[model samples]
Target: MLTLAETPPGAVVRVIEIMGGRGMRLRLMRMGLNLGDLVKVLSSGPLRGPVYLENLSTGVKLALGRGVASKVLVEPQ
Candidate 1:
């Protein structure tokens, strides 16, 4: 498994796990980032601070902070 933030841009990843408590988990869920969902990395910088992701299920675009994105584990497909 690899972190979403560490994945290369344009790669499709399946959300495998989320590491956080109830509040944080719920917040991420509301943003359409749920387990088993597939997301594509849209863009990233050199250090991977902020990344743009597109939720395949909802077709929603979200910019996630590196710290939060790092907690999301995914498998490339």
Candidate 2:
């Protein structure tokens, strides 16, 4: 198991769960980041910034701030 936020760039992870409110949770869900979904870390931020991720299912990419990304639990493959 590994935190999605902690995963290095170019790595892939499977979403486990999201810990947050409905608003924030819904936002990520709408972005195709649902549980069991696979995502690839495109790039991490500078020092402590946001992280870029590419959705394996939808082929969409998104940049999530570190704080938010940290809340997203995942399993590294």
Candidate 3:
């Protein structure tokens, strides 16, 4: 298991857990990122920038801040 922020670009992973408050979790869910969802890391920005991810099932892409990405736990798929 690894945090979303640690995943390399182009890596596919399944969301396991989100270690954040209700609002943060809800926000991610609204963006199609929920527990058990498969997503691909499109890009991880440099210098502590946002991370870009794409949902494999919905083809929805989202740009999340590094803080948020660090709270999302995932497993390699």
Candidate 4:
């Protein structure tokens, strides 16, 4: 498993866990990210900026801050 931030661009991965407080988890959930969901790494901004991701199940694309991405654990699919 690896953090979402470490996932390579275009890689499809499954979300395993989100390591943060309840508010953080709820925020991600509201964005369509949840445990066991498949997420694709779309693109990463330069200079440690936001990382773009696509939720395979919902077809939603979102940008996550580096810090948040680092807390999202994923396994390559």
Candidate 5:
């Protein structure tokens, strides 16, 4: 499983797992990211900044901090 933080811009990946605690899981869920969702990496922010992505399932775009993104496990799709 590759973390979302490791994924490069322009890649499409499937959410495989979220390696975080329950609170983190709830936060991500409210942000519209969930297991099995397809997401496209839009911009991998610079200098350990946030990662911007688009949820292919809902056409929603959001930004996630590097730490939070690293907890999201994904597979290239």
Candidate 6:
């Protein structure tokens, strides 16, 4: 499984698994990112910076730190 951190820009991916605790999951869910949702990577900052993406399901855009993004498992759609 590829992580959101490892996905390149412009790739549309589906959320498969979130390898973290309830707090993290809830945080993401509140941001409109949930399991099976489709998202596209908009851009990634340099030097282990945040990852910018758009949740296709809700049309919400967000930027997540690399550490947080690494826990979000995804598959290309």
Give the best candidate by TM-score. 6
Error of 4 at 69 (Å): 0.1
lDDT of each: 0.90, 0.88, 0.94, 0.94, 0.95, 0.97
TM-score of 3: 0.95
Model 6, TM vs. native:
0.97
TM-score of each: 0.93, 0.91, 0.95, 0.96, 0.97, 0.97
Candidate 1 per-residue C-alpha lDDT over 1-77 given as tens digits, one digit per residue, 9 for 90 to 100: 89987999999999999988888789999988899998999997667479899999789899899989989999998
Give a tens-digit lDDT track for model 5, residues 1-77.
79999999999999999998999999998999988999999999898999999999988899999999999999999
lDDT of model 1 at residue 25? 84
What TM-score should be assigned to candidate 2?
Answer: 0.91
lDDT of 1: 0.90
Compare candidates 2 and 5 on lDDT and give the better one: 5
lDDT tens readout by residue for model 3, 26-56 = 9999988999989999999998999999999
lDDT of 6 at 41: 100
Decide which is better by TM-score, 3 or 4: 4
- What's the number of clashes in each of the models? 0, 0, 0, 0, 0, 0
lDDT of 2 by residue, 1-77 (tens): 76777999999998988888899888998877788888999999888889999999789889899998989999887
**Clash pairs detected, candidate 6:** none
lDDT of 4 at 48: 95
Q: What's the lDDT for candidate 2?
A: 0.88
Q: Between which residue pairs do clashes occur in model 1?
A: none
How well does candidate 4 score on lDDT at residue 46? 86
Q: Order candidates by lDDT, high to low.
A: 6, 5, 3, 4, 1, 2
TM-score of candidate 4 against the unseen true structure: 0.96
